[model samples]
Target: MIEIKRLKFSYGETPILNIDELLIPYGEDCLFLGNSGSGKTTLLHILAGLIKPMEGEVILAEENITNLKTHEMDDFRGRNIGLIFQKHHLVHALSVIENLLLAQYLGGLPKDLNRIYQALDDVNVLHRKKAKVYELSQGEAQRVSIARAMLNKPKIILADEPTSSLDDENCERVIELLQYQAEKYDATMVITTHDQRIKKRFENSITLR
Candidate 1:
């Protein structure tokens, strides 16, 4: 489960995000909706432990992450939090499979080729596993990114502006894929987006102004 209370964040003197209390149960899906400056990404980053909030507590999987040390938090995030960025950060110089290997290596997990292969197959991008990242099409690259995120079998998945650049059809497909993957792994999925196309798809949503 994920819970936040008395949450607040800022950039120097400018306040960015504030929340009194929010709770999301395990295996649930939620959407954070807002316009460009609504702090949606800020909230997601805080949840991912990428950025610290000035005040309040963030509890994930029943642990108070706000109190964790830097290295502890990094280890926790690597093992429990899966992140999907707005841009696919795959290295163009590396093959698709190599990128996933790097993810596992950085996470301090042993190299498991079978896990990588299953993840690729699940995302329907196994055919491109040996190809360079640049060789995959936009949609294919996104799938690879998704596979990488799920490679660790994270308990929580955080996605930032995943469908902002897609057309209607592709937008739906991407969201569905994310939801399916989250459900398959029984992970709590949180997506932050300004796109209205997916707003209705999520029953539990929070709007930030």
Candidate 2:
């Protein structure tokens, strides 16, 4: 489960986000809907421990991560949180398999080629395992990104505007893929987006303003 209590965030003196209390149950698929500048991405970053809230407590999977040191937060996030951004964020110079290997390395996970291959296969991109990220189509690259996020079988999946850049068909496909992987791992999935196309797809959503 994920919990946020008395959350408030600001940049310098400008406020960005605030929430009194929010709870997302374990294994639930949830959405945070908002417009641009609504602090949706800021909230995701806070949840992922990439940014610290000025005053708040964030608990993920029963662990209170807000008090963790920088390195500790990094380690926790690496192991328990899988993140997907609007951009694919893949290294163009590296092959798909190499990219996943790097993720495993950063996550402090042992090199597991079998797990990497299975993750790629889950996204239907196993055939492109040896291909450089730059050589793949937009959709293919996104699939590889999904595979990398699922490589660790994280307990929480956080996606920020993951489908904003895709066309209608690819957008639906990406959402399905994310949902499938989340269910496969029984992980809590949280997506933050302003895109209205996907609003109807999720049954539970919190709108931020």
Best by TM-score: 2
Superposed model 1: Cα runs more than 4 Å off: none
lDDT of 2 at 24: 90
Candidate 2 per-residue lDDT over residues 2-115, each given as its tens digit: 899999998888888989999998889999999988999999999999988899899999999999999999999889999999999999889999999999999999999999
For model 2, the stretches where C-alpha displacement exceeds 4 angstroms are none
lDDT of each: 0.92, 0.94
What is the TM-score of candidate 2?
Answer: 0.98
RMSD of 2: 0.8
> Alpha-carbon error at 206 in model 2, in Å?
1.4
Q: How accurate is candidate 1 locally (lDDT)?
A: 0.92
TM-scores for every candidate against the unseen true structure = 0.97, 0.98
Candidate of highest lDDT: 2
